[model samples]
Target chain A: MSGVSENRVLAGSPSTGEAARGGLIADVPRRALILLGLFAALLLVAPATVGDYLLSVMILVLYYAYLGLAWNVMMGFAGQFSLGHALYIGLGGYTAGALFVHYGLPPWFGMVVGAAVAAVMGGVIGALGFRFGVKGVYFALLTIAFAEFTRILFDHWGWVGASSGLYLPVEYRDTDDLWLLRGSATMFYYVILAMTAGAFILCHWLLQRRVGYYWQAIREDQEAAQTLGIDVFRYKMIAVMLSAAMTAIGGVFYAFYYNNLYPETIFSMHRSIELMLGVIIGGIGTLFGPILGAIVLTTLGEMLTGLTEDLGLDGIKQMSYGVALLVIIVYRPGGLWPWLRRRLGLEKPR
Target chain B: MPIDFLLNILVAGLLTGLVYGLMALGLSAIFGVMKVVNFAHGDMMVVAMYATYTLYTAAGLEPVAALPLVAAGLFVFGFALQRGLVNRFINATEHMQFLLLLGVAMVITNGTLMVFGPDARNVQLDYAFDSYNVGPLIVDKVRVIAAGVAGGTALLLAAFFRFTVTGKAIRACADNFTGAQVVGLHVNHLYAVTFGIGAACVGVAGTLLLLITDVHPHLSTDYTLLGFIIVILGGLGSLGGALLGGVLVGLSEALSGALIAPSLKSMFSFGLLILVLLLRPQGLLGKQA
Candidate 1:
């Protein structure tokens, strides 16, 4: 089946032993290490040098990169595709936003609740979905159903502003509120950058462990993984929980950064698709793929937006993205990262 | 629970549910043969609505009168889409199928938005807003006609699938692609025809929808999701199941909108879908594959 082989293509060249033998950093090729260092340096310095407008764009790129990495843990490594990831984002954002607005609680504390709620939601979905043996496209549809249900429920909820939408009051402050997570563009950029870095390191560490191998095995062939006594259900649940909770953190960051929440916008299928594009474009299972994808997609989208606006051609950007997705699926199914990996001789066939 | 009120809801649900059934029938048939979820289905419906609206506005034809032309146009478009774009990825991964469909959906919706703008347009006839009383219960005149048309289409589709050689071939292909190929069935042609028929069903629905409501670029996404729920509830690849599932969903939606909040109608359907998936993964009327 194509499902089995797509994961095989990802797990093909990289032998697990290399990544497991030390930390991810310890086993990295020297060139990749150098590139990682250079990239880190660039991220650290960009906020300082870039203008406010560009800083905002950088923040969005980092935000997507962070979300993509979290999602990659589930879809890429674990081979569980969730098409309704906006559930976590919407839940997490609403939880944190409601707390701040209603109770005057800071975002730091609110993020804990946000992540917890999302993890619980993930746990329920995984439990119900996996226990019943819903897999593949059916599983994806199940996730969409849950997200749409939640979105509709939230739209009718009064405490969260119903369909009118919830907006946090903008108290103009010159300085960044570090604890409260209220800040200017530069401050938010650094925060998102740190989050992206944290996610990368955490994912790298996780992928080097037994759980990562179990996930790959389960993803590749569930029956085979079960034959080897891999406890397939538990590992898949772990992936879901981990991915959901991490994405919730992104939701919290998004809430504070944007200072608004809407059931339609936050929980829309459009949001979920936008979140997954980076990983799909960059590379699904590769560690650095989401990062590269986030940068490439966000940059291209912004450029297209600017160009289309200048030319008075509305919706050209969205059409381009759709066309791009179709083209990529048809011609470049392995995505940019895998192609680059082969071209650079980073992953040679055994 | 006034008897008349409940009866009115039941009547309305059955009428609208017939439309939903026809829409889901097309979706189910497409999945039956192709094993691909057509995410662009709703967008195609919207396109049909726009086409019908254009015909009605330009030619001064009634909305319902423009149904055949729109259905033919969409059938050709669906046939071309399958023969050209989707055929290449028919054997690809399930993930690829979803991405391809989603991409097509995005392109169609955005392209329509670009061309038509975000404004909602509707074709209004004198009888559209009128209602009729049959004894104690009242029913909308437009809904009655829509229900009749949808039911007629479904019956015609069922008869075609049951009696025609092409329909048998399409079903055979759905049952087993390689087996059908070995049996000398042109699987590709059947696929194109099945997709075309599905799109044609949506065309009929789009035309009917223009009578009671408005059309916009994003109108079809709601229908798309509804179609998915109906298909799943009826059982994937089961035509009759989609019809029954659509009725069940339509009835629940109507009842909920009447008794509970109108906004929660879709939520109710989604909850039912999740419940069904958890309890009966094979669907209510669907046989286990």
Candidate 2:
């Protein structure tokens, strides 16, 4: 009944066998260094070369890239597909924003508190959901339900300002308030860039470790992985916890950077879908795919919006995105980054 | 609570449950026969609603009068979509197929949004607001009619599956695709016809829904979630399960809203889903995995 033999047949074939073989250490490290250098250079040069609109777009790209990486840790690497990822982001934003507004806590400390709260929430949901044998689409639905529940709860709760929304005091004059993270878009852009880099490195390190291998095995075949003595529940819970914590950080960044938090907007299914879109369009399991996806999607979105506005066509951007998604899935299911990597002779042939 | 209030809630809940059951029937039929979860099922319903709405507005016909045309139109639309597009990925992994359906849903939703913008529309039948007396209770005439229509459709569907050759072939294919193929069943045509039946069910449900509530482009998500929950609760591939599950959910929602708060209605349903999944992974009427 279990498709273990089918999996073996599919995985052991030579076409995929090459993919399973880890690259040479020299080539891997060299590629890693090149990517790192390129990123650092972009960070330093982007602010000067790009205008305000482009800078804001870059910020969004970086934010989404960070989110995509965070989500991939759970969904792609660990094979736990969560459709309610906005729960973490919403929780994180509300935590930090509420604390900053109510208690006068600095954004830095607020961010940590937010992340911790999100991780704990993730742990509880993951524990309950996994323990109850909710997997696959059921698990996805559960996550969505939880997120929606949270949104509704927050919508009526006035302590977090309810549906009217919460606004952080923006004192542009206090540009040097690094602790509170109140500054120009340029300053916040750098902060997000730094966070994105840190998250990327963290995910790369995690994926290279034993836990990563355990996750992949579990994802590919949970029953077989369990038969091999792997603690599937523990690894999955950890993946969720880590992913939630990381997503919370992104939420905190979103709150302070935007200086606004709306339950409907932040905790929306749309935000979750947007994050997943980055992962899907980039490449699910690949290390660099999320960032690539975020950049490409953000750029394409901007272009589409501009084109629609220029042509005086309403709702064309969304339609274009839908068409793009269809074309991408039908033609290049492996995602753009992996396809490009294969084509460029940078990675081993599929 | 007053006795009349309780009775009213109960009646309303039962009627809504019947309608939900009708909607779930399409999903259940498709799943039962094809083993594919059609995420776009709700969108098809939306399409039917739009078609019905257009007929009501343009032709000045009542929703009930437009039902047959809408159902037939949707049946053809669904048959073509499934035969032309979805069948290509029937052999793909379930996860990939889910994604594909999600993509299809997005395309449909966006296309509708582009066409209609973001406004709610309702089919205004003069008699929709009418009421009827049933013994000591007064009920909305439209709701009673919708429920009757839904039950009749279910009965007719049951008969079709029991008495018709193509319907039996569909059931046979659902039981085992490979065996059905080896036994000389036209698997492809059966699949398409099964989908067409499902779509027709949704079309009927959509027309029925327009009698009681407003329709909008975004209504698809709420209906999709509700249908999925009902189908899952009823078990994956059982028509009776869908019917029973829909009634249960509808009753719970109504009772919860009457007893607790209106905002907690969705939460109650979700809680029930989790509890049922935990206690009986196979669902109330589901076969053991």
Candidate 3:
């Protein structure tokens, strides 16, 4: 497998191994860390200078980055292509929102509950799908069916406001309530940043672990992974559960940060596609690819919307996105990040 | 309560199944010929529907009357798309190809959204509302014609595949691409031709559907999902499988709607899909994995 060869090269080189084995080592890419730190610092401080609209866009980028990373774990790493990841996100949002609305539970607690529910749901889907040996596009369709089913069911159920949507009561004083996750734009920015950071760390850690190696093996060739006694099913399930849990947290962040939850909006297939667009256009199965993709795509989307508003070329956003996807698939199927990595001499040829 | 009601449901189920079968035919053909699940099948149907609608509204022609032109146009379109766009990713991994198709589907759908807008349009025919009473059961004339058209198309497709040289070549290519290539078959042309046929089937289905229902840009998602379910249920590349699966799904939907709530209709089909996947895995009529 390609990843196996890449892994051997990365781990086999003693100098690189020593650098990667420890934090802040001399062999580590100091420029990359410095750039990342600089970016983080800018992100943290930008809300002060940026307007509400820009902050909103930033929030979307962070959200997409977070969701993309979560999705990448199952899809890019574990080779499970799920089309219904919005199921976890929607479930997470709804669970937390419903708990808050009905039981008046604090959002921090509700978030945990939401993540747990998503994890369980992921487990069920994983067990049923993997146990029955539903592979490839069939498994993807299965996930879509389940997600759509849940969406329809939730759309019908009125307790959490159903299709009408659930709105978080806007209390002026509640903005200061960190427990409820209610805050101003700056606070929300920091919160989403922290969440994005957490997701990135989790993904990085997982990618560096033994389980990551197993996942790569399974992804590259399931039969080979099985022959190597990698317990494909278990690892796949673990990836699903972890991915779901992370996505559920994103859902919670969405609900609280946005202060609204709509079945159609949260659980829509469009949302799933949006989540995938970032990863696909950036680079699937690569660390930080989703983040870069999210940033680029979101920025482009915002720019397109702005252009439409200014120049009045309606529907250009969708057209541009279509064109972008086509161009990427045709010219650089591995996506912009991988292409950039090669161009910049960051990625060595096999 | 009455026999007529049951008969009406049965008739409705059969007609619906025919439409489903037509939709699945294209998907099945693409899958069989190229081993590619054309997720854009539904979008192609949507595009055909839009074309039919445009012809109907602007040219003042009946959708059924416009079927041939629309089918021919879409045949060209599908051929061009497959040859120009899809052929590039044929050598890529299955996952990449799937994503590529998905991206293409997205482009088609969003492009439709841009051109047609999100408003729903119906191909208004004078005969749409005209129905006949067969004893106690009321049968819509349009639906009956649609069923007949669908069945005829399916039969014609079956015959074409069985008898035509290009069709045989397509089948050979599908069965073994490398072997067929070695045997002097033009695999690329065959693929484009198969995709064109698939798109043509969707065109026919779209025109017929316009006779009974409305068309929307987003309706492709539902059709895609339904076609996917039927294809899976029928076995991926089997025409007979698609037909049987479509009928089964249509009947199940009808019965479930009759026995349960209308809202739970899709849930029933989904549940059946899960059960089938668990038990058979190869689908009811699919070849062994």
- Runs in model 1 deviating more than 4 A are A1-21, A310-314, A348-350
Q: Residue-wise lDDT of candidate 2 within A1-350, one digit each (tens)?
A: 11111121111223332333553232243554676578789777899999999999999999999999999889878888888899999999999999999999987888889999999989988998899888777778778778877887788789999989999997648455678888888888889998998888787666656687788889888999999999999999999999999999999999998888998889877688778887777877777778988988888888988867765545565556566666666666667776766565455323
Model 3 sits at a Cα RMSD from the real structure of: 2.5
State the weakest 10-residue window (summed lDDT) of model 3 chain A: A3-12
Q: Which is the better candidate, 1 or 3, if ranked by TM-score?
A: 1
Q: Which 10-residue window in model 1 chain A sums to the lowest lDDT?
A: A3-12
Candidate 1 residue A79 Cα shift, in angstroms, is 0.7
Please give, for residues A1-350, the per-residue lDDT of candidate 1 as tens digits.
35224433333335657656755566566666776799799889997788887888888899999999999999988989999899999988999999999998998898899999999999999999999998888899899999999999889899999888888778888999989888688888888998999998888877777887788888878999999999999999999999999999999998999999999999988888889988888878877778888888888888998877866667777787788788777777766887776677655335
Off by over 4 Å in 3: A1-21, A24-27, A310-315, A342-350
Kindly list the per-residue Cα lDDT of model 2 for residues B37-150, writing each as its tens digit: 888888888888888888888889888888899889888987997898778778776656666677777777767777776789997777877998887678999999999999
TM-score of each: 0.96, 0.93, 0.95
Per-residue lDDT of B155-251 in model 3, one digit per residue for the tens?
9999999999988899999889889999999899999999999999999998888887888878877888888888888888899888888888888
Model 1, residue B172: distance off in Å is: 1.8
TM-score pick, better of 2 and 3: 3
| Per-model lDDT | 0.86, 0.82, 0.82
**RMSD list, candidates in order:** 1.9, 3.7, 2.5
The candidate that achieves the highest lDDT relative to the unseen native structure = 1
Better model by lDDT, 1 or 3? 1
Q: What share of the true interface contacts does candidate 2 keep?
A: 0.28
